[model samples]
Target: MAEPRVSGDVKAAFALLITLAALTSLLGVGALGWVVAPICIVLGIYCVLRAPLRSTMLTLMFFALTLENPSEMPAAGQWQSPFYMVGALLLTHFKTVIGGPWFFGGMDLMLAAAGVHWFVKLRGRSRGIPTPKPMIKLAHLCYATIAFTFVIGKLNGGGDSSMAVWQIDRVMYLPAVFLLCQAAFTQPKDYMSVGKVILVAATIRALISMYVRAIVPATVDPISGESDLPYTTTHHDSMLFGAAVVLIVALIIQRTGPKALRLAVLLLPILFGGMVANDRRMVWVQIILVFAALYLITEPNAFKRKLQRFALFMVPVGVAYVAVGWNQKGGAFKPVQIIRSAVDSDSDESTAWRDLENFNLIYTIRTKPLVGIGYGHGFWEVWPLPQVDYILERFIPHNSILGIWCYGGYVGFTGLTLLWVAGVYFGVRAYHHCKEPYDKAAALVSFGTILIYYVQCFGDLGLGTFTGVFLIAPSLAIACKLAVKSGAWPSALRPRQTA
Candidate 1:
């Protein structure tokens, strides 16, 4: 028999194992510092080289584990494994290292090297099919907008330069966007598989956040300004509150199974913990939107059936909320105050509204309707009033859209509107083609979450955080995947859809 060839990927895996093992022995894991630090470094690298979907799944699991127990890994070395120790310190401060600069930077390095290697391997062969035209166009538009902002800033000379850097970082949205482009050219089923990875990662992140927010104890630093943790407290409140919204939408859309209830039960502590954190405003707002949207999305018959089922489901939750109303210092769902706080024109809750000394966003819109300021600039700078200065007090704008307007001016504002409209249009089309119930449900979860984020942006910088990045990236990837699967992207280009 002829000798069989070992695949390139298998060879790569073998090489990775050998490298890790050698590093372990050389570093000497007999000491506590040596044991886990190298292990984590190897795992982090492993996550980058694996399939994007698989790597994300592992990343989520790691995040959950770390959040649940900050001290789960052995302490990093005082000297030897400095990279690992530095990563640990960063993780401790930010509460997420997997999605932070280290992970991305490492991946970028590996990808650049691998891409060159692959190019050499295919030196005489044709290049892999280029990404789809439409997807490429969208990516180009995004990239162009980012470049345009920087150029405009330079041309103007001494405009908010920091805002230019922030807009450039917005290019981080590109990786996930390119992933969607890949999805457009690949099999549709792989999209769901990829989506499942994202959801699982989110679930893992949520579970870990539950522990952090509910059970973990942490301290706030007065001087350097950071969370000091003997790991005493976690930022559970938002995680739980957000989880609740994710849960209800998941159930309604039927994405998660019985696990939804189980997760909800597990998440109770997080919900309570979030309330204690005093970040109740967004949580309460999210909850109301979840229920309201749920009510709107269902048909008459299903709505009636769901109403009965919901009542049953609400029994325990309602009772708990009622009983623990004040006692659950860690809970959300303050009906009256939530609405009042969110809409209160004079309070910090209404940052832009109060800052501008205006009661309505509509009024502010009338003042600078076309371009607005730019991404971080908002109306406050152009006007430069005492109240605006007092409210933000040397801070960025709370409203994401307003910030775009302030920084980018009319041109950037137009680009933003188009970007969001494109997102919604394609996202809805993706929702329509989803065949599986769970897939549909997950799509709905994304839909509702995006809606909440978009609405929240009017009052807060909702889409500005890494949380927003996680939410939008997966949603867009899933959308592109769905479109490709439905034969909407072109049969020759589309791969078969799978669950």
Candidate 2:
């Protein structure tokens, strides 16, 4: 042996331990526990030896544990997040059956190890380059705004606990977004990697949605607990719609670009699979708007050329649609009932009520006007009974503006609104000015996709969830990059001149 090559030794050790653990576990308890314990010990050792693999393994373990027993995973719905709540409290308060007490001690150790690794990497790479001062300032500003709102809510009283809750929810998103922004700023290639990751994640999510729609009966099981599981008319549709929009832009860019068509081609089936899952509004709108943005932003001559080619391609698609007309009843292309119900929405009472609720929320935001009622405070609570009727269960105000009103109040709201205005200004300018066609296409598609979220938020609180926050951050970072590339902002903080 070559004096125990580090990589080879680690790989061999990992494989051997994993194999022994699996085999021993299959035989059952006593030996199984012993075998697995050694493997975990080895894993801890190798994790330090192989940082990337360790991080990946840790993430995988987290997801696996969550999916296997979602109910048990740290959550406010029942038991709190394992580390922060139970571990920090109960485990610390009393001795345990296994090991030295302290509930969250192991978690703290893992987190500390991860933090050390992260700082080491950061220090190693930040050789002579200046720290990202402007980005850091913006990050601090966002953090301050959140802290200020929280402090204010605390000072105000317990009467507005709901508002405080909403504000607290938004604070969770900053870290994830900041991490993504850091990745984009330091390694733009990472953004593209994230794009591919989204495609992979979306594919799995689409498949899950398809299974849920086609296999799982809609019947509610009383024994399983709860009266009814919430049904989403456009549940599986978001990923499909977003992917389709991306695909269309990808196809259009391919017309004149020196770029790979593989991503778009690869993603098409995933989009179709999503479409088959039956939710449509968000997806369909995303597709339309992305192309529309592309058309709007490109130079007139280039756009005309692209449009002509698109029209030529669509002729064949149109001809096929006409030829097949309603003949494929049970085929993959069959009409979806969800689509029909969605389109024929004028008379639906549920649709009317949902829309009305959304409208009322918007109107209430107008009442508080500036600063609104304080971050996460009023709007939704006042929503079901705007006239102070019995408080219905507080909900996520479907609209983003309403959410801002409920959570951020005036000061936080002002900061966010300025960000939006700046985002739009830069986004349009970036699309028009970027030198690389693929980069331009990516920017425009991202801008349009994000814009769709703006529209979708008019009747949904899509941004409140952590998943939604992750989705939004990348789009914002891309927009920011595009803005910088386009020179929409002056080299200084001053506004750009209009010719």
Candidate 3:
């Protein structure tokens, strides 16, 4: 969708940022960034205090689009990201004492501010503010799971207590952010703004992806290099790539004009460039699944009928193409190659590793089916695999669904299952009950995003990462908010009736 008008506040924020960036260039960034850093922090603090919700969203966007997760820390051939500095500000504990602080640093403060404002506004009986009861219940479920798992782990002597805490925190990050987003929003339409911002952010991220692709060698080894080489970016980016595609498609439909065309023309190439350049096969699979999901959720129409007709003819051709390209090495078979590399362990070492890891996780669950090995312990290895540099290999598994089942046993698995099931239920209800097209379209976007995120967590280690939480939390919040607005969800608390 074409973005709304550029407001004065947005202009001001950009101008202020541009001025700060200018200082970095004029005084030599490397040597003098120290001087500018504190100034920026002070300014940031002021901005957050003045406008917590907007600032919170922007920070999330930065996390989603700018920073890389620890899994893929120094992206090859690209300039270094200011990861540790920014990550510390977001993730480190900010203490006023020598000992550990009571607070959770900047992120906690931001949420606290936003939560307080939400309470004040709701107390005054503000119209259009959503009360997501389902989301609130789901948050409790998530926290309870963590608490239960942590205690079980400690009692069982699973492993490092601190590491156990960190492991559970990462998993709980989604529900925590989901609550914050639910509180921060005042109206259903607010979701559209979040969607637009993420789309734009993904586009910018795609540009960076293109740059990384250009400078690096496409493959590390001559034979099997395509599969042997690491993914073009982080594993989580497969989610982002799929997100950009579905969001653009869902937003642009049912609209016409130069604006629509221009939006598609301008953003699609950059977004797709990042997607293609990134060279992760899962993105392609996720994209197809998301589109199918969106189609199934939406009401049937002429466009869909046409698509069915198109598919009837193309299905055989697609089958034939796959038959021929399954073993071919030509560029025409690139999509087929990606599919093969993803599923066949022989073609890609990464896939083989995940398969072995899956067996290990399954064994871990079978051994401790009730309380689980808890969060602190590593997955029990029936088929031990070589250790990688990743420190949380034991804690975080590629198949997060199975990982949860193993870590938390039946109880934690129930929590995760209910959370996502509730999210999907709300998304579908919102889409069907929407009174307006914008509402419907937004519901679709949120639904598709949540689905893509689930695919990531199922296939990759997305459940325990910042990127996945940032991507999924906002979308889940939006879905519930829309469902409530559309009356598909009953009011959590009835408003005061005025005479």
Candidate 4:
């Protein structure tokens, strides 16, 4: 007689059920507890099974949801809920990483996980894990400065709300994420996997955007004649999708996978349509700059052929855009018409407000050139409109470089600038060093992503916001890791090989 075997999946399911039963018995007394008990237990089991990868995936999912439904997600603090789940998981499985039992949890769990992983790796310094390079060291310093700046702001009665301070602190996770990549990623495929995950997330985001736009069509304001929906939010979503599109196109050119290329090509029009519908002038500028940079960086012959194919592919997209515009009265999808609409300073209040904002930020930076005003605090003395109550609530400069200068001071701004420079340097180095076509393409796309973000910083909030950090940080980390693995870094700084 054969004994029945319990598979790993069955064992996992049983363990989950037992855990849920125990949790329900102990804490599920009320109706609310009964509901929470099962959910918590399931998340606990999931964390135990996958640990940090699960954490990363959840983080990405949160971003995707936010992009898809920003208006809905923040209504009941729903946007921050995923972070709570991730925090709980990390705390429950603290033994898996170096850290243990953290109380203050949120997206900060990502930081804690990275910190613990780095601490454990420190014990194995002889095992070929290199010392932190100047760029990485500076990144750590920037993270510390961000924390110190927030504390100083709070102590000085600068910061308004506890939540605001927490929001600022979440950006600090960027440095920790970068450090985690150095430890976690050891090969080109690992880096490629990161890109694939991001692209898939973006694809989901695009679908969601299409769904939302379809369900809730933009309404026209009778007085202003502008669309009632928030264009900036849509533009930001489009930017994320645009970055994903660029990465995919670059990978396809690098010949990473024929199937991926085919799929990406199929989705190109959908993604581009979302961008056009968003109608952000700066986003369009960014798309152009990104493609231009990609063209310049890739091999000439390969780029030329790719461009010819792309031009032919875009003919249909051009016709579709024209048709979409034709459906609307007085709307034409000519390039000139779109560009003129974007730069219509007379009609565009947003652009006018941005100009004024930048002037005020620059004036404030002149006063405190060293460190600017601390976090959560804005310079209202120089505000153009002191009468408006909401004007006083303007904490960020709405421009990443200016925001850095205002919040972190000159030192912080310089540190951030150097971080971008380091990113580009590493990306280029990785591209040059990698032998395989696909690896080179990945490196090139990574470089383009950072470069595009840098260009985007001039007009929009760049690294200061979660969205900007989410888009750029992981790619930068992967680029740096790839550079290190390819021995593009100087020999003295290279990780030593252990017996």
**Each model's lDDT:** 0.46, 0.47, 0.70, 0.59
Q: If the candidates were sorted by their TM-score against the true structure, best first, what order would they fall in?
A: 3, 4, 2, 1
Backbone atom clashes (below 3 Å) for every candidate: 32, 12, 0, 1
Using lDDT as the yardstick, the better of models 2 and 3 is: 3
Model 1: CA > 4 A from native: 1-135, 158-163, 171-244, 255-278, 297-300, 304-333, 346-395, 487-499
Task: For residues 459-499, write the lDDT of model 2, one tens digit per residue.
Answer: 44455333344455555566566556555544633443669
lDDT of 4: 0.59
Better lDDT candidate (3, 4): 3
User: Could you tell which candidate, 1 or 4, scores higher by TM-score?
Assistant: 4
Give me candidate 3's TM-score against the actual structure: 0.85
Q: What is the per-residue lDDT of model 4 for residues 1-499, given as tens digits with 9 covering 90 to 100?
A: 1212335663565467446544543442346443654464455344423444323433443443243232222212312222333223322232222234443432344455445644654334433324237656868776777776676567657577644453365356566556555544444466566666666666655665555555655667898777765442344554576677777787677777787678677777777766655555666777778887777766668659977799899999877775576434443545644454445544357666776777788887787778666776775547664244343235644566676777667766775567777888888888888888777877887787787677566766554444556666766776776677677876635445769
What are the C-alpha RMSDs, in order, of all predicted structures? 8.9, 9.3, 4.5, 7.8
> Candidate 4: RMSD over Cα atoms?
7.8
Instruction: Point out where model 2 deviates above 4 Å.
Output: 1-135, 151-157, 160-163, 183-185, 218-244, 254-266, 278-280, 302-346, 380-395, 417-429, 479-499
